[model samples]
Structures are given as C-alpha cells and as structure tokens.
Target: MKEIAIAGAGPMGLLLAIRLKQLGYENITLVDARAGTYTRPGILNASIFEELTQLIGLPVDFSDSYHLKDVERSLYKIAESLNIKIMKANFTGFEGKALRVEDEHHDIHILPCDLAIDATGSRRALVNEINRLFPDAFSVQPIADPSHKKHLMAYVKVEEKTDSDPPSTPAPYGFDFMVQKLEELRAMGWKGFVEPGFYALPLAKNKTCFYVEIPENLDASQHEKWLKTVVAFHTGKDNFDYTLLPASRKYGSKPRFLTFIVDPHQVNEAFFQHAQFPCVIPVGDAQIEPDYRIGIGIKSGAYRIKCLLDAMVLEKDQEFHIDFEKYQKELAAAMQMHAAALSKFYQEKQRSYEHYANLLSIYETVIASASMSKQKELQPSFAELIQAYAQSLYDAGNNALESILTSSGDIPLDKHGLIADEKKLEDAIARLIDAYKYAQGDLYTMASLKLNEIAHLYEKLADVFIQRGAYGSSLKCYEKANMIIEKILKDRAESVLIKYKHTQTLHKASRYEDMYDMACQTLSEIKNIGMDPEEKKKFTYKLELNKALALLHILHIRKDLEERDYYEDECNKAIKHVKSSPYLKDKHLLQLTKLLGEIPIESMCNILKDGDKSDLAADKSKRR
Candidate 1:
C-alpha cells in the first residue's frame, strides 16, 4: 500500500481518495481545513459526476445545489464504515516522507505520508507556494487569466408559479427552449441572458435556476439593481399583468451576488513538479480552470482524478505520483485544445448577440408603430428593413470568416491555416453569393447592400486563392469584386470616392496590380459619369496619382521600360488635366509631373510580355 495525503476534501480530493482505495492503495488519507467533503453551488449535468460519487458508494439525487458540508458529512460516515482516515487539518507543505500539517486543535505536526495532493479550489495553498517560490510554473494570475477580474453572479430565486418540470438532461443542443425563453423575456421586456450567456435548468417542482453572465467590467454595487430590474420587468410588478405570466423571483428576498471568473481558461500555465522521490501534485481547477459557460468544471476535474488513478494502477501499484508527469503533459495539451474551442464558442455567441439584437430592436419598433396606429399592424419601415438586411449581410460575411477554420482544418500553426484555406473560402464565397441573391429577390434590395457585400466577399476569396498559389483564380475574383463596386458606384459621384476606399484594402493584402487597375478604371468611369465638375476633377487627380504610383511599383517588379513609360503617361495625364481644366489645379499633380520628368524612360519597350500588353494601339486595333 502506498501512503498518500490528499489536501482539501472538495469533490476532487475526496473522490481521488476513493479511487486510490479501489486501485488497491490502502493507506490513503483525505484532509481539509474544514472537516468535510465539498461541492460548490452549480447545476451539474450529472452524467459523469454521479459515476464519480458512485465510486465512493455514495449517491447524489442530482437535483439540488450540492452542499459541501452535507457531502463532507456523508464522506466522514463512509470513511468510518471503511476504516479510512479523515483528518481535519491545514496543510503547510511537504517535508520529505511526511506532510507538514496543522490540525484543528492548533497543533502542528509532520504527518508521515508518501504523497500530498492539492485539490483545494481556486485559492489553494499549493498554487500560492508555486507562485511565491517558483514563479515560472504559473502565470501572473494564479488560477485564471490576469485580465479577467472577478465578476458578480446573482441567484435570486424566481418564484415558481407554474412549477419546473423535474431535473432531466436539457434538450440535446436544445436551443429552442432557450429561444422560447428569450422570446418570453423579450415580450415581457426583460432581456439579459439569451443565445450566448443565458442558461436554465428544470430543477424541481418549485424553481428553475437562471444564470446571468455579467462581464468583468461591471461593478459589484450594480448587482442588486440589475437583478431587481430583471425581477421587476419579468414579473410585471407595476401593472399586475398576470396574463403575461410575468416571471419574478421569490418576493421579499433580495437578489444576492457571488463573485466568479467568466473565462478561467485564459490562464495558460499548467503545473510544476518540485520533488522527485515522493511526488505531490495539484489536481482539477488548481491546474486548469475552465470557462464556466461550458458547465464542465466538476466533470472535467473528476475525469482528471480518474486519469491520475488509472495511471497509478498501470504503474504496478506504485505511488500514484510516479506517473503524474505524463498526466501533466497530456493535461496541458487537452487544456490548450479546450481553450481554443471555448474561445470560438464565446466569439460566436458575441456575434449572434450583436446580429440578433439589431433585428430584435427593429422588430420591436415595427410592433410599437403598429400598436400606436388607429389601424391594422403597420409594415416594418424601409429603414428598418434595410438595417435588418445589412445585419444579415454582416452575419453572412462573418460566417465565411469562421469557415476558414471550421470547413478546413486550418488553425494558426498549420501553414495552410486561417485565411489560407482556398477551397473553403471559395465555398464561403458561394454561400454569400447565394445569400445575396435570395435577399435581393426576397426583400426588394433597392440599393447597394447586396452588391457591396458580394464584392467584399469575393475580395477575401481572392486573397485566399493567392495564398493557395491560384493566381489566375485570384485575379478573376478581384475583377468580379471590382466590377460590382463600379456598377454600384455609377449612379452617384460620391459613390466613386467610396469605391476607392477598397483599393488600399486590396493593396494591403498584396494585390497591387489589381488595385492599380481598379483605380484606373474608376478614374476613367468617373469622367463619363455625371458628376459636378469640381468633384470629378478632385477624384480624377487622386485616381491619376494612385495609377502613376502603381505603375512605378509594376516597373520595379518587371524592370521593363513599357511599365516605366506607363508610369510617365499617368503622371503626364495628371499634369495635363491640372493645367487644362479651369476648375482643377493640384500641387500634388505638378510635383508628381516633376518627379516623372526626372525619371529617364528608355526610348524602346523591352521585357514586356506579349500577353501582358495593354496599350492604346491594342485597344484602337480591337475597335477597328
């Protein structure tokens, strides 16, 4: 039998002791400052947790906030029945083959033990020691991200009038119940938790537990006020509208608050082993804190305990600590993967919130307008419809962005990760185009919403192709993107200026030649488009200057005289327009002309590829 001392008799610590006994370790001891096994207030999914508790021959009803005191009480009885030792003591540290322990009687003693495991929650002493003595083993923030300050959560009991329908696994991926709940809240004028942060469980016949995720930036004092507002609006406290089935917390009791981290996984540091002969380690949250939104903290922690014990059993019943290094490495890798997935999940929630809230607001406005009318329900305003359409377009664009990771196994470390997934990006562009087509036909898209969205989508798609070595496809994508922009901008002169904004975005992504052609075509089109003379001149000068700079860049790439002369021609055009037009005179254009004059272009074109030729002679021959 291996002698092991497990600290902090929380669920993980207690369960670990039980697991060791099953693995044939007889001299196992459980210790905590408080005299009990513990569980915090949380709604466990109960699938795996019950199995862990069952290992100790203890049973949980799985329908209530598990009380640590009661759990510890039960653990003590079980220990008594099995002849396993339970100690009420504060652990100081390890002193070789014994534990430096301070008992409840205020007496300090070094108790003989081979291994000391820390299962103390967030504020565990081992974490403090590691931070104080060996700083590199942990991050600046002990258990969670240093950036995430403790935030408040309120658990005001909503009075159970209709009664909850017993505890059961919620609908699998059951967003409908959540959607219905959100609709009810929206109708009742109470909205906080929804698609992203909202969660509820049918606990018993009396009350349903609701969680409100407050961001870390909020203040503590606002907890009561925020909860009160939820209660007041949910219950219709002012109007007594029982028909609304208004939700309210139990009357007379104030909504209380407790502090917890919103995103715990942001703390990346996993563990450090201080000794070798007799090993000690921190388990569960003391190692990796999970995002509470996933509801897997307890379950994940218990799983770790099982892994630790399993590793020990495989080591031929040697002290469990011997195999923990493997556990730590595996734990770190799993934590990393989980953190990435959680971040994606959180970001999706945030995006959905933004998109849905805008649409919800518009729907509410249309409803309000209808109610105030002396006639039938009014139609949504054109502005509201257009705004909703814009939001939809925005969502479609974001979906494309996400596919860069999802559809393709593209992650940051992979050479073909992020936006470099060409095939996936092409598929995303197709989806966006389909969405645009439907929106155009469905909502009578009267403006440039579909056009601009499709254009930008193709721009991104082009960049992806470039990364995948499909330069021809990239150029085609850019051409389509640029054509749509020009087609949309043709009706208004100011819109031409808007089209120029995309050039830099294209250039920023290394699409210089594409950007150059876009600028040149827009400038030429601006001349034919009906614009105020002064406005046309100003845009013309800007476009001409950009075209000259682009050709100069092209010459650098080709080292060909044809490209250099093209650069000079663009500069001369700007100069001629500045001198001839009465309304146009730009100092920048004259300066550019002077610079162009200084550049000595050789008399003949050389190194210009036959297929790359784009000149007035070629155009006039085609016209003839």
Candidate 2:
C-alpha cells in the first residue's frame, strides 16, 4: 500500500480518502488544522449531494447551500468509520519523503509520505511552499485576465429587530418551507429589505447572512461610505438604516463580516506534475480556483475527485500505478480553456449588469415622475397603462439579465461548459414586445417613452446580440428600433439620425441594397426641411458616403454600369458636403476619395473577397 497523506480535510480531501480506500489503498491519512470543525458557509448543488450520498452509502441531506462545518462534520464521520486516520494537524510543507506537519498543540513533526495531495482550498499552502522553497517546482497563472478589475463580495450577518424571541433550533432548509415561513413573517407585519446584486441566506433566529456584492470602483477601505453609496445609488434613498443593514458589526449578536476579492487565478500543470516529488499532486481549489460568485467550487471539486479516481486509480487488487502524465495534460488543458472562457463569461455578465442598471434606473424614474405629476383626469387611464408597461419592462429585463449572470462555468471539463438559469433571453424579449404593444398613452408622453425608453431598450438588446455573435438578430433589433424612432420623429435631425443608425446596422449585416435605400430616402425626406448648416453638412456627408459604399458593394456582386455611375456621383456629393464642414478632417478622406475614383472590375471583386474573409474571421473571434 502507498503511504498517502491528504492535507486539508475539507469536502475534497475527505471524499478522496473514501474513494482511495474503496480502491484498496490503505495507510491513507487525512490532516487539517480545523479538524472537521468548519464555519464558513458554502453552496451545495444537487450534483454534489448525490455524489456524497452514493459514496458514503448514507443520505447526505439536500439544501440550497450549507455551512462548510456541516459538510465537513458529516464527511468526517464517514472518513473515520472507513478506517482512514484523521489527524488534528496542519501540513506545514514537504521535503521528498519527509512531510513537515504541525499538530493542534503547535508541536512540529515529520511524517513519512510516499505521496502527498493538497486539497487545501484557495490558500494553496503546500503548492505555494513547494514553489517558494524549490523555485522551479510549479507556476501560478491567472485563470482570468489579471488586468481585469476585481470586484468585492462581503458576507455579513444581518440581525433584524423583532418583537418575538429567538428560536430554540436552527433554520430549516427546504425551499417550500422557507417560502411559507417568509409569508408568515410578512403576514405578522415583518417588512424585509432588498438591494441590487445582493442575496440573503437564512441563519438561526432572526439573523440572516447577507451576501452583498459590491460594485466595482467603490472604496472598500471605508465601510460606511461603500455601503451608503451602494444603497443610495441603487434605491435613490439616503435612509441608510432603512435600506441597508448597519455597516458596523456592533448591532448584531452573531458578528461576522468577511470580505473577499473576486479574482480567479490558477496554478499551471507544473504544480501538479511535482517535478521535485513526482508522487505529490494538488486537487480542488488548489488546482483551479473556484468562481464562488456562481457557486461552482464544491460541485466542481466533486467532479474533479471522480475524474482523478477514474484517470489514475484502478479497481481493487489491480496494479496500484498512477498515470501522472495523463492526468496532468488533461488538467492543464482544462485550466487554460476554462480560463479563457471564464474571462469572456465575466465580461458578458458585466455588460448585462450595466444594461440592467440603465433599464432599472429609467423604469424607476418614469414611475416616480408619473406618480408625482398631476395629469388631466382624461389621461389617468393612459398613465396607469404606461406605469404597468414600465413594471413589465423591469420584470422582463431582470429575467433576461439574470439568465446569464446566474450561469456557472464548468472548469474541470475538457471543453467549456455553462449552465444557464431559468429563462432564456429570447423569452424576455418576446414578453417585452407584447407589453409594449398595449402601452397606450397621450401623444407626447407615449412618443417620449417609446423613443427614449423602448427604442433604447431594443438598442441595448441589439448590443447584447452583437456581443453574442447573433448578427441577424442584432440587425433586426436595430431596424425595428429605427422604425420606432421614425414613428416618433420630431425634427429633420431625428429623421437623418434614424436613417444613419439603420444604415449602419445594414452595413454590418451586409444588406447593401437596404442601406442604399435608407440613405436615399433620408436624403429625400430632409431635402426641403430647414436645418443648421454644420449639422446638416455632417449628416449629409455620412449618408452620401455610406450610400456610395453600399452601391460599390452591389456593383461587386454583379456588374452595374448605371449604379457605378451613380456611385461616383454620390462620392462627389459626399466630398462636396465633407469639404463644407471645417470640423471634418480630410487626411484619410483623400485616400478614400482616391480609391473610389477607380473603375476596375477586378479590384472591386478582390476588395469584396477580402471583406468577406475579414467578416468571417470577425465572426469566429466574436464566438470565442
């Protein structure tokens, strides 16, 4: 039997010990400073619960999440019962066969170890020591872009003042049961609170653990200022106490405030290869840092344990050889791929949140202004309809944003994987469109709401689609939004702006004819209208230039002598307008004009072919 020592008796270490024993590996020891008494709370999904229950031959009760202490205590009993030695000691470091350890009494000792596995989450004690002492044993690399701005998450105990005494027992876990309990509290006049990007996990008595996600750029050094700024910005209220819990822990009986910087980094394969000690390997968070924001750590840890067993360990009574090279290659590739994908996931989530914030702010402002303003009695029904529409808009927008944000990325898998939440973004878009159709109001308010609010919503949706590489979807959204803008147009400038925006989308979607028609129609519509000379000149220059380019694209697809003549004329018109505007630079303009004066059929085809290749490359890049 191999003398194996697993450090850190967390879920990963305990599970690994049980599996190795079942595989007929004896003389295995599990060590941790906490000695199975854990306090930090962690989320447990269905996958982890099922795995633990099957491994131990006992039901591991399911819950939305659990405190690390509860999971450790339960797993500790199974580990001990299986004849796995459990030690109340800390893994200090290792030197070949000599493993340095510190007992609970703080006395140092060295234990013989043929192999060592580090399951210590995030602290990465053993891995760090090996790299520091040996200098060439391993490497640390950021899974996500290190240059990305790090966010903050603060987990604090929130104590609410209640007239009733504290409960004798702990809180329940079932979802339906918790819902019923919350309803009962609300029925008895208990008014709870809500804040953006925050959630509450119930604890014993009237206290709950509020996981407050601090937005970027907030000064976390000043606790009060950060909390107040977050609340006021989200709720438009300065009554800090009423909105958010007190920043100080003095008010709570169970005072707990733990803050962590949300930065995801990982160790390279050299850390696992153990060039110094080939028998040494790291597991769980020590291998790849978990994205705790979406609760992927525990579940991923379970997956990693099973994968490690499958790849390295064999059935009972078989050759007890480990394929170290095979596992290292698998893990390294997974880490690199997961890191690249996770970076994009966070970027998309940040954008979605920003879009959500804008929509929420607009919705709240509209509702607030409508409530305070005195409108004609005849318009009361219309005002109510508009308010109802705003509420629907907020609901659908939240659903769309949450669908992507709640998704968890799979780090252990060879390929990138993401599990989305309940509703798809397409569903939310459908619901919003349905609500908009019924939002009837007086002319001015309706037009303002449609143009400024609804149209902008579609534009934001288009931006998201563009980010997702759904060019056709983005083009449709932009075209529909431009139609909304046209319906509510109040001036010649508005007409010109709508056409410019629509033609831009058409150009991106490669609808050259539609782009040409839009520019032509807008030029005709604004021909007789009075406008500022400078503004008109700028719009005219862009519209004619785009119109000329659209015609060039059409001529590339097929020879068109008449259209080619029209294209040259349009280019001259663009030059004339651009020259009139002293603000417009003609440095690059001269180069573009020089190219457009050509009449070669072969050149246009080559340019068109190159454009197509670039667009395909862009599509591939966006998908990544």
Candidate 3:
C-alpha cells in the first residue's frame, strides 16, 4: 500500500482524505495545525452534495448551507470512520522525499510517504516549501486587483417571530417613503446593503451574517474601527438592527477578519519531477484561490479531488504513475476560467450599481412630480412603481441572504432588484415630461416644483453614495442633481433651495465658473423675492457665503486679481450680514466669521501660481 499524507484538514483537505480512503487508499494521514476550530460558514451547492453522496456511497444530508464547523466535523467523522490517521500537528516543511511534521507534543518526525498532497488552502505549507526549494519551478503572481483579499464578517441571531401582515398602503413621497421601506425590511431581518462594501446575509430563520470588504490600503488593526464607522453612518433608530447589531455588543458578534489568497501560484511539471520528491502535489487554495464571494473554491476543490482520484486508478500490468501533467493542465484551465468569471462578476456589480442609480433617479422624479402636479392620474402609476421597486429590493436581498452561490451563475447585473419593470420607469418619466410640457405659465412653475424636490433628493442620495464609498455613483448623482437644478433655473422657477443646491453641486463637480454664475444669479434673485425677516437673513447669509467660497475655488485654478478682490468683498459682506442678523447666536456669528477668515491668502496665492485643472479637481476632492 502506498502511504499518502495530506496536510491541512480544512474542508478541502478532509474531503480529499475521505475520497482517497473510499478509493481504497489504506494508509492516509491528515495533518492540521487548527484541527478543531471553525470561524465561519461553509458554502455547498446541491450538485456538490450529489457528487459527495456518490463518492461515499452514503446519503449526504442536503441543505441550502452549512457552517464551516459542521462541514469540517462531518468530514472528520467520515475520516475517522474510514480509520484514516489524523494528526493534530503542524506541517513544518519537506525533508527529501518525506514530510516533516511537528506533533501536538512538539516532537518532530519525518513522515515517509509515496504521495503527499498540499491541501493547506491559503497557508500553502507544502507548496511554499517546494517553491523555496525549487524557485524556478513555480510562478506566483498576485491578482490584478487586490480588492477581494481581505474580508470582515460577523453573525447575529434574531428571534423567530410569527408571520405578520405587510403594509397595505404605499408610503409617502421623498425620504420618508425610503425610511418606511427600510424599516419593514429590518423587522423581517432581511439582508441588504449598508454601504457599498458592506452587506448582510441571512443564514437561517434566526441567524444572519454580515460581511464587510476591507479596503486595500487600510491597516489590519483598523478593521473594527472602519466597520463601526460604516455602521454608525447608516444606522438610525428605525434601521438600528440592520446596521448596528452586526458590529454592536448587544448581538455579541465581534467582527472577524479573513484573508483570501490574492496571489495565485502556478506549479510546473518540473516542480514535481525535478524536485526529486515522490508525488508531492498542491491542491485546493494551495494551488489556486477561487473567488471567496461565491465560495466556488470549495466546490472546485471537491471536483478536482474526484478527478485526481480517477487519475490515481492503477492498470493491472502497468507501473503506477499519477498523471501530474493532466492535473496541472486542468488546474491551469480552471483557474483561467475562474479569473475571467471573477472579473466579469465585478464588472457586473459596477453595472448593477449604475442601473440602480438610474432607476432610483427616475422613480424619485416621477413620484416628486406626481406630488407637485397633484394629478390624480399620476398617483396610481407612481404608487405601483414604488411598490415594484420596494418589493424587488426585498426579494433580491432575501435571495442573496439565503444562499451563497458556488458559481457566478446568472446574477441580475442589469436589474439588481431595484426595479422590476424598466418600462414602468420609462413610462413614468415620459408622463412627467408630458405634464411639464403641457403646463402653461403658472402651471409650468407648479409642474417644475418636482425639479426642485428631485434635485434635493438626489443631493441627499449622493451623500449616501459618498458614505458608501461609491465615488463614481455619487458623482453621477451629483451631476443628476445639478442637471435638475439647471432645468428648474432654465424655466425661471422660484426655489432658493434648488439654486443653493446647484451652486454646491457645481463646486463638487469642479465647475467653478458655472458655480460662480449660479451663485451670482441666486444672490440677485434673493433680492427680488420677498421673505420673512429671519428666513431672508438665513438665505442671504448662506448664499453670500457660498458665492465667496465659489470665487475662492475659482481663484485657486487661475490668478485673477479682480476675482480675488471680489471674493474678499463678498466674504466680508457675508460675515457682516451674518453678524447683524438677530436670528444668529453669538457663537454662530463667530464661527461664520472664522470660516471666512481661515482661507489662507498665501496658500491660495501659491495654488493660483502653479495650479491646473488637475489641481482644481484635487482641491475639490479634498474638500469633499
């Protein structure tokens, strides 16, 4: 009998041992440093379960998912039943045709084996030793994007409740409607996005897991702090459970950190042949780290083991030799395909975000217009659109929470559970456009009130996107907000709030010229419009402050003495206006004056001397 030693008793290692034993390998030893520890859940597909059942000649209890601990325990039990020796030891290194392992008692022994498999997953114990011994035989390359390498995860258990009736009526317009829908999801323990990199998955009726993708440049120690920051930003009284419990002590799920294998190590035939070691092969994450988001690596590992077992079949009259070449070719092919799929998956994610942003803009515009127009005809269709979008989010989020896919599969990249019917959004936008086109004089202004509301809502959504780290999506939202404001302004609509928002968006977009123009126009309009004494004082102070800030930003891009004097004068007037207002408290006036005074003249002049368009963008980005 040929002796086989498998290092690392993770799901991949244990599964490999169990399969080898079934293939009539009598002497198999499994070595692991962490033999009895389980930190997260294991993902399994129904197809994998089918294959496992056939291999073991026993029914694999099929389930939607299992904890990583359970998967390890089950496989360990099967290994024990098969009388395969398992050592609670660390695989130290290889010593000339044998594996060197340190036992639990710290005694070193050279394990003699005809075949050795490195199933050590990301640790890559045996694989790394081989690379060190024969550096030229393997090529280790880091993935193009390291964004998927680090992850943070935690679990929470919510009490199961009896079925309750959902809301019968649709929610009101603007932010309140979104708040209500989110609250409904929270009550049912539905999983959804908290931030761009942060999301939740429901494990069972009472259990859920929250995951956060760690940023590449962030230090490992600051992971907890970053998670807390994201939670605090998104959490409020109504959606507290959705955001707070994952990182909070009340649920008792302190976040755990996991590192994925970012660098894929490819082994050439020389490593196996030229190393002069007998049949030392790398498998599972030791060979390749499949994308962790889908947990496809485990499935891939299982499939490869089955192929390896088949390749191990001995012919009656032939010398026994493992087909290392075939295995390497298959491994390379699989990794190539996996890499392509992973790239496509991320591209799909970006597209999904864009689709969601588009749908959200259209829905917000339609609903806000319906409110402004007070046309009973628009109300029913607007309500249906709201219901469809909310229901889609609920369904898609729950589906994602329930199962971890083993493949990229058919992820709804274009739709992404934001809206069910593209036609609905298109129809609604068309209707709103028609309403605006048909309105006359005062009615035109009334119809265009939706523009102001939509612009304000888009600005708020953009802020949310910024908090979520979706910088591109946020920029798009800001652009949309500015576009709406432009539409309102073009119609000569009367909304001081929209004009103020226009100036802010232009500043954010780094369009300093447009901002200055809008600010100047708004300041002129404020003079003509009558307002209450306190209200007018507030608008005048804010508008003048924004105007001066815009001019200062413009001066950063170019040296203009006229513009510099104009900004200084504008700042003084704003400071003076804020100070004279009876509505302003002493502290408020002091803070306002300090805000204007703190713009460093020398620094602004230095920037003006050496600034370009890139400098202006950089300055704006820093401010944001």
Candidate 4:
C-alpha cells in the first residue's frame, strides 16, 4: 500500500494505525478530528485488548483492567513513537480516493490515500456521505435508529481513592454510589429519560464511568452546569465524589447509538476484489454501534479492526488485497447478536435491580451495625451470607445474559464461545432462583417475572439439549420450565394448553404413563376453569384424544394375555367417545374406526390358528 489515511483516533482507529505501522506500510496518516480526544468514554474489554496488542507486535503490558481512555491513549502514543504521522483534522467527506478534511483553521484540503479507516464513532460521517454519492454501493440504508430510546451515558471521575492501595474487587465504590444514586433518582426524572438505571465501569482505580440523558436545548454552559448538578446529587454523601464528562453532542438530538452494516452481498465480496468501499472501510461505532445496554461498542470496534489487519497480513505474500468482505459480514452478525440480546438483558436488569440494590443496602447495614457493636468481632448469620452470595450471582447472571443467542433464535449459547455455552445460562438460572427464595413483596414480584423469563430460556435450552442427545438434561430443563410456567399461569386456559403440549412430548419419548397422567390432569383442569363452556369442552376433547393415544402406547408395550382385552376395551371406549363427541375432528374419528375394525379380524385369526394346530395334534396322536 503506497499511502493509507485513517479517520478518527479512538481505540480502534489508534490500533489500526499501530497495525499499519507494524506491517511497515511506508506512508500512513492517523487523524483524530473529534476534539482530538484519545478515546471515546466507554467500557473496554481488556482481554481482547491484550490479544489485539499482541497481534500488532506492540509491547503494552498491564492487567486486563484498563478503560477506554487508557487503551486509546496508549495506542496513540505507540503509533506516534513508530513515526506514524498523526493529524488533527475533521473529516467532512470523501472526494473519490482523496479525503476531504477541515483543519482547525477551517481550511479544507483533499488529501489522497490508498485506504481510509472510518472510526468516527456512531456518526458514520463519511459512510453516510459516500453512500449518498454512490447509491449503488450498498443494498439498503445502513444506519438503524432505535425506536425505544435508552441510550443514556454518564462519566464518573473519582476525586481520590479511600487509600492509595487498590481495592481487591473489580467493582469500584464509585460505581456502587452511582447505582445507589440511580435508585434515588427514580423519584427524579432520571427513569423517564434512561433505562431502569445506569451501569457503571471504572475508568481508573478512583474514576467510574456512566452515561445519562442530556436534557433538550441546553447550551454549553447550561449543559456543564447541569452535569455538575447531577454529579453532586449522586455524590452528596457516603464519601462518593464525581465529575460528569461532557455528553457527545452531534446534531440537535441525542440519538441512541445507531446500528449499521454494509449490504451483505457487497461486504462478502470485499476480500477478493478491490471494492471501492474497502478503501473507506468503516470500523467501530461507525460500522455498527449496539445499544449501550448490550455494551459491545469497544469490543466490536476492536474485532473489526483486528480481522482486517489479519486478513491483510495473511494475503500479504501475493498482493495488497484484504478480506474486508468477510470482516464486514462477521462484524455485522456480531452486532445483530448484541441487538437481539438487548431486550432480554434490559428486562432482566429491570426485574433484578431491586434485589441487587437490596443486597448492597443490606451489606452497608451490616457493616454499619458491626462498627457500632460492643463486641470487637461481629459476624452475620449463615442466612445473611447465603442471601448476599445469591444476590451476587443474580447480578452476574443479568450481565451475562447478553451473550446467549443463535441465528434461528431457538438455540441459546454464548456468542463468543467455540462450542455451545451451557454454563453461562445454567449458573445464571441457578443463582437467580437461589436469590429469588428470600425475596419478598416487590422483590418477590420481580423475581417471579424473572423466573418466568428463565423458564422460557430453559425451554429453548432444552431444545438444544435434545438436539445434542443430552436427553437427561433436556428433561430436567423441561421440568424446571414446566414448574415455573405452571405457577405463573396457574389454572388458566393457557396452562392447560401448555400441559397438553407436555403430554405430546411425553408421548414422543414413549413415556406412556406420564403422558396419560398429564392428559387426565389437564382434562380435569380444563373442566374446572371458568372459560366459556364451548372452549372448555374443546380442550377437554383434545386431552381425551391424548389419553387414548397413551393407552394405545401402553398396550403396545405389554406382552401378557391381558394385553388384548385391555387394548380392545380401551379402543372400544375411545371409539364410543369419538362417536359421541360433538367437535371431534372427522379425520380422527375415521382413523379410530379403521383401527377398531382391524382389531377384531386380527383377534379372530389368532384364535383360529391355535384351533387348527390343536386339531392337527389330535390326528397325529391317533395315528401313533
């Protein structure tokens, strides 16, 4: 590559700059237009950061506990040390292979480069403009606006640590204070503007990161003033202090992060041919920014850039082409997975928030009480420890739930795993249930809702389990789901209908007794429900059919002399019921009649064959 120009110097952009330099591309220019801030304010996945750094042959060593700013700043500094020319210019749009950039002095220039990286966050400034100019480049509109807006971001900077020594837990006290304040802000207009609450990440040992809704029509001064008010409100007491970082104001509206993808067909062809768009590849939020709720923006950007870099390196021997097409498709799929997970993760967060807060509240209460106690050593009961432990699990589960999704929406496994992910879901369900036990009142209600969701998830997991031939685990999942669903639906018609399905499943597995028992119970439940008489009668008839089918299965299983009598009697009874029924389907009645008639002829043949053998025996004896 003769010359490559990259737009934006966030973590992804910075990393791509470093990668290009490592690969020894002669002329490379890295540009950071958005106020030249080293990083966007968000959580960074430190694990992947390490891998990417290693891939680029960069020596950045630290624990996997860095924030967005740390990564971007480090990458930017590394790029500079490698003699990569960095520019602070705003990218207005593109002029063919030439990039149009506006400098700080407001002077515009068309700088030509072989390739350009669009790491311009969610704005996708050049991507949008390029598509407008080249309508045939993509299949459809690439940007997706979220209908249900929950894109509230907050930045929490701690003034000082309680002590110089770092805390043992990854969770910072600032985050705890942030959460508790969110709990209080529900009385304010915070809930109206945000999700149930804000999620917090520590930028440093002393600094925590959060996001919020910036009120409408606020000027720069007013915005800063408002942010200060919010900071004070959250850190007024309990030794928590913070400073709100300025919100990212693009256009007039504070849009939730928009999701984008190049058209699938075009993206798939990016590697083989020198497509026009690869020269202007979009990475990070510019490509597809998932909801803050899903929280994959940082990782998503890193993955896209890494894939591009690898593709370039692999094919470096032959030519200058990169696997941009495959990179875009995989990246798009990853983004969609996050979007799919948003609804479920958001709901779980809402339902489980109370218990999460209560646990924290209880912890503070215990600590405070212990400090005031006369005994030097004070300890909580076994029950209290269990309660806290369970609560912690639920909190972790809620966060992890975002990873479980499949293309067909049937299977649920972690998105990042090489194989089916069971433990993530299993641990979540187990811990949630454990926490649900001690829940009371509002906590109890929320837990019930969450349990219902877990039940649904379990049903999906059971399908995957059965497909994998883990029938024992499948059955256990089914039982758990059935139990939770039954309690939720009670004696309602829906429950009866679900029970009918259970009977069908049992029949499929040849569990005849279980099928018959379930069918009878469902039949009785239908009769007891106060649904319309016609509705009840219809459901009851279906259950009777299921019961008869189970009986036929039972007869087939038996080898005794009584098998025939029992089979005949059950068939006759079922046949009679079919004829008497008002709404019995015609096909079912005809099948029953045909089966009933065959039984008699089969029985006669059995008896006559035995008599013939006996007569032959008698004749032989006389001869002897």
Q: List the candidates' TM-scores in order.
A: 0.56, 0.49, 0.48, 0.46
> Lowest summed-lDDT stretch of 10 residues in model 4?
264-273
Ranking by lDDT: 2, 4, 3, 1
Which pairs of residues collide in model 4? 153-211, 153-212, 154-210, 154-211, 154-212
lDDT of 2 by residue, 1-624 (tens): 257888888888988898888777787888887766655544444466676787667765533455655677777777877889888899887766757889979998777776788888778878887778768566766777532333333443333354432222223333333333333323332222112244445545444554444434444465444543443333333332332334444334322454556677676653344445536678877877766555666666666666677666653654355766676666666666556666766654443333433433443444445434422321443344344455455456545544544234111111222223323544544444444454444433543443445456556666666677667877776776676666555354655765677787788888988988988887776776578877787777777767766766666665745656656556456545554646555453443433343433433323333444354445456657
lDDT of each: 0.53, 0.58, 0.57, 0.57
Top of the candidates by lDDT: 2
Model 4 lDDT per residue over 128-200, tens place: 6666787545332333333234334555565654543222212333533444444444334332212233235
Show the colliding residue pairs in model 2: none
Ten residues in sequence with the least summed lDDT for candidate 3? 162-171
Better structure of 2 and 4 per lDDT: 2
The residue-by-residue lDDT of candidate 1 on 1-624, one tens digit each, is 267777777666766776666566787777777655343445555455366466655663333554333454555555556666778898886565667789878888777765667677665666566556556565634333332334444443445354433222223322323333344434333333332233444344334544554445445666544443333333334221112112225422232346666545323444445553234567766656666656566667766666566556424545444555676676666666555655665555543424544545545554554445511322323333444544454456546646554344332124543335556555554444434443444443533554565566666666676677666656666666766665554666655755565554455455668778878778767878897887877777667656655554555465755656656566455445544545434454344333333333333122222321243235435657
Off by over 4 Å in 1: 37-40, 53-76, 92-99, 112-114, 139-160, 163-208, 215-222, 231-257, 266-271, 275-278, 291-293, 313-321, 328-341, 357-399, 402-478, 484-624
Instruction: Give lDDT tens digits, candidate 3, residues 380-443.
Output: 4444434344433333333342232214321111334222233443333333333454444554
Model 4 stretches with alpha carbons more than 4 Å out: 1-3, 34-53, 60-70, 134-184, 192-278, 290-300, 313-319, 323-624
